[model samples]
Target chain A: MVVNMINRVREQRPLIHHITNAVVMNFTANGLLAFGGSPIMANAKQEVADVTRLSQGLLLNIGTLHEDQVEAMILAGKAANEIGIPLVLDPVGAPATRYRSDACQRILQEVKPTVIKGNAGELAHLVNQDVETKGVDSTGEADHEAIVRLVAEKYQTGVVCTGEKDVGCMEDEVFVNETGHPYLAQITGSGCLLGSLLTASLTVEGNPEDHLMATLSHYGRAAEEAAAHPDVEGPGTFIPRFIDALAMEVET
Target chain B: MVVNMINRVREQRPLIHHITNAVVMNFTANGLLAFGGSPIMANAKQEVADVTRLSQGLLLNIGTLHEDQVEAMILAGKAANEIGIPLVLDPVGAPATRYRSDACQRILQEVKPTVIKGNAGELAHLVNQDVETKGVDSTGEADHEAIVRLVAEKYQTGVVCTGEKDVGCMEDEVFVNETGHPYLAQITGSGCLLGSLLTASLTVEGNPEDHLMATLSHYGRAAEEAAAHPDVEGPGTFIPRFIDALAMEVET
Candidate 1:
């Protein structure tokens, strides 16, 4: 399954537009590149629509929410939607502030993304539920199936709750993907890269549910492979090996 | 060496203050987390100085330069310099515009950086040379030897030029650390991670030259290891494994 999508990406080399925060901008770009996808990191409102329209998929992450970036996400997301491109929304730190919650809600209402990727805690807050979130990081494990279900139903979109065990839920069906390592949580943009991976997978599968499943499985399997190597001791070394594994795994 | 740094970070988790661009901010933070360093992504002018004082290392990235962020970088970089904390600069998109080059020069003048990280093109521009930089990304190889001595001599700061081959250079000494797959270039924040790695390494090493050599060598070697793995296929898979490799390479 991973090989199939990897073949598609290598053959098609889709362009992904990201209107994300400044924090993970470089990592997100590199993640897409490792996945055999072209990345365009554009945030200015003037260029968002143009860049999004030209790309194959759109990823909107509100990690560092600001008035200008929020507007750009909306404009670019709308353009991507109208052009039949896949849209992935990463509502980062949504529950931390009213401003964030409102901005995320507005984007949800306006963009109507095909997939919404967030930590279980972030998902709970996005749907107006209570959650114990520390700063922007999730406090619970990735195996919380109930929270994933609630978020999927509330948003009417695919919900991916990533942690110790990642779950991808769409309405009634849920896929429990247990592929990643514990080291993933130690890093910041692990979730953001998952978003980029989902976008890359969607470029091939074109099904939000299947795309999410394949990505989580692919990421987890790669993490498992890395963990098997005693030399892969921590996150620093794990990062480069993870990319190397990605390049090979995609090709089957 | 990479494993030692990873163990050190885990043993003594340091808070890294970053006044970076909105882009790549999430990836930087995540890279820090993967390495066991806490990242604080704040760029507000009012609080930047206060925030820098508490950080073990300060990262200044001008990927998406703005007037307000420029001011904050100066304020934070100066404070970091005065407090004897290690300061690293990622001159993102320098020479793209007059505003960027001017701002970079200003920051360099106001605060003496412990180390500077960027591509060959960016480093060339930072030192006021004509390198034909394609936007923020480098078109040349990481070890373009042409400008290494020039950059080191002009800046009076250690420089890590990353690409297919990573080069760490100081005023009199230069080290060519080659490790990393070609696929790394496809990803965006791979360079940003090196910047964060430099910060994490500085928190422990204290010497700018040592930090640059350790970071470039460890990152380079890990990339080599990551590329040797069979299951690692693309960027998606490469990420986790790469982090694992860095964790193992940086010892406590």
Candidate 2:
């Protein structure tokens, strides 16, 4: 099933529209391309609606929040909704500052994302639970299943709470994926890139639940493979290898 | 001299305040860290001045310019000027949009950057010279030395116009560095990363001319080394190796 979903992405060549943060634009774009999806990053409010309308999926990441980009995300998200294409939200750094938190809340209330993905802290904060977040990384542990259920029910969307083990929940069903590596935490944008992969995965025709699980598993396994490279001494070397691994045709 | 300058960056551990676009923030930050400089990326207008005041150097990149970030860059640039720390301006995509051109002009006029870095197209646009630019890349080649001299003299700032050969000029003298690889162009943020390296290099005590040359040389040599790695099949694999090479303590 995972292999079919992965092959679907490579066959369809879906164009994913991303209104993501500046910190991970290049990385996310490269990752999307490596995973066999086309990426178009357009964030100006003047053009986001048009851009989102042309894409198969929309990804809204608030990693580096700015007032204008927040507005642009809303515009693009609504456009994607109107077109009935999948939209993914990555509430990056939601617990780091009020500005980010408020922006994520606003986007959530307005667009109603198809899938909402983040680390434990961001997902917990979205559901009004207390969790410690440093910058964009979650520093506190939460009951991933409970938090995912709360968010999935509240937002009426699929929820992916990622950490050492990734949990994907939709309605009452939960899927746990334990395929990634700790080295992913040391690199910036690992979480952000996962959001991009989720956006691409949703464009494929399949069970939304299975699609989300496949994305999490595929991405995590890729990181594990990259980390096992003999030359990957640290996070710096692991990054490119991860990209190459993402591009590989994995036999599931 | 290059080795001494590089050692200075490792010793001083300058905290570089970056008000750069979002497209390359992670790569730029990682590159700064790899080159032995501390990086702080803050662009919110509310706190840019305070952040700039606390740093050893400033980098203003207009790669992903938005209205609010342009204001924040001006704020941070002025604050850096007040403290008399070295400031580097990367006029990314200056020739691509009028808004970017105006923003670059405003920052150049007000901040008086210690070092101005851009490709031939950007420098030509800054000087009102006709040069073809495809996005951020210079599509046409002109007399790079003359353009660098014109920009350096007009702005009363050192200028580095990068291309196949990087030309650095301070008033009447021009230095050319032919040290980079063409593979560098295939990757995103390579030019933006160079601006980060230049900012870190400028914080070290040295002749401004030699500092610019040393930065270009160090970065180019790193790219060359990364490209030569047996595992580096293309730009995808080259990225991580490049980061690792940058982290290596080269004896210059």
Candidate 3:
């Protein structure tokens, strides 16, 4: 299933329009390109509507929220909705500042996204739920799962909370994939890159949950492989190999 | 001299304030961190003046220029000028767009930068020079040298033109360092990252010419080493190793 999905992504080369923050643009662009998807980062309100109309999927990330950027994201998100292309929202750094929190809530309220992804901290802002116990997991992990479940239910969209264990929740179906590296946290924008990968995967043929699981497992496995490489001395050395692994997976 | 400059930078950990483009922000930050300099990217016009006042140097790159960011650059540049913190201007992609060209010109007129850096194509816009031959070098190479020299003379600031060979000119001094690989061109923001390295180097106790040449040499050498690694399959793998090389050079 993963190989078929990879082949479809490479064959289709779907365009993923990004209205994201400053910090992760290049990494996200390169990662998408390496993974057999095209990325267009047009955030100007004047052009985003037209640009988003031409894309297959749209990704909105508020990693570095600004009033001007939020305005552009609204324009782009509306265009995506009108055109029926899938829209993915990653509310990065949400609720850290009043501006960030307001921007995320406004975006969620205004735009109808197909999938929502972020870390537990960022999604906690979206879920706003007090958690009870879930199985044998610790409170921390259980809290994350509950948050993901609530956000998925509330938004009527797939929710993914990424950490040591990547948890995906959609329509009473919960999936956990534990195949990542500690080095991921050391680097900036790893979550933002996941948003890119997820948005790209969404454009391919299949159910949203299937694409989401494939992206989650593939990204995790790549990080694991990259971390095991002999020359990956630290985060500095791991990023390139991780990128290479993302590409290598598609081919092999 | 290179070792001493690197040592000074590590000891000082000079804060470099960037009012640059969005795409390269993460890479520039990581590269500077790897090179042992602190980076602060704050492009809010409301806050740039205060931010620049606290920084040891300022780097302005027009890779992704917007009217709002241009305003912040002017504010930050003025603040850097006031505090006597060195400011380095990289006219990235000038003349490619009307907005970028205008932004570069406006910044040059408003800010007295300590050094001006770009490639031959970009410096051509700044110099506005008609070239003649120098020695037996190709007209292409000679044209580049003429552009670098004229810009240095016109700005009365150190100038660097980067390409296959990196050329630096200040007053009557012209230095060339030829130790880069094809892989450097394959990656995004390598030039913007150069602006970061040059800005960090400028804050140390050294002549502008000396620091410029050292940054050119060290950056090129790092690229060469990263490209030569057996694990580096392509540009995807080249970036992480290149970053590791930047950090490794400072330590070992």
Q: What is the TM-score of each candidate against the true structure?
A: 0.61, 0.67, 0.64
Instruction: Give lDDT tens digits, candidate 2, residues A100-155.
Output: 67778888778979989988988998889988654456768788888999899889
Model 3 lDDT per residue over A3-59, tens place: 888778888878788888777789887787777787766655655676687688999
Which segments of model 1 are wrong by more than 4 Å?
A1-6, A97-99, A141-143, A205-207, A227-234, A249-252, B1-17, B21-31, B42-65, B70-252
Q: What is the TM-score of chain B in candidate 2?
A: 0.98
Q: Give the whole-model CA lDDT for all candidates, comma-separated.
A: 0.76, 0.85, 0.80
Candidate 2 residue pairs in clash (backbone atoms < 3 Å)? A22-B22
**How would you encode candidate 1's per-residue C-alpha lDDT over A1-252 as one tens digit per residue?**
656767788778899888776666776787778778888888889999999888999999887666777789999989988998888999886775566778899898889787888888888887667777655676754336887787777777777887767777875778888777886767667787778878877888545566678778877777677667666656655666676666664545
Fill in the DockQ of model 1: 0.25
The TM-score of the first chain in every model comes to 0.92, 0.97, 0.93
> What local lDDT does model 1 show for residue B73?
90
**DockQ, every prediction:** 0.25, 0.19, 0.16
> Distance from true position, residue B127, model 3, in Å?
9.4
> What does candidate 2 score on TM?
0.67
Error of 1 at A194 (Å): 1.5
User: Could you say which candidate leads in lDDT?
Assistant: 2
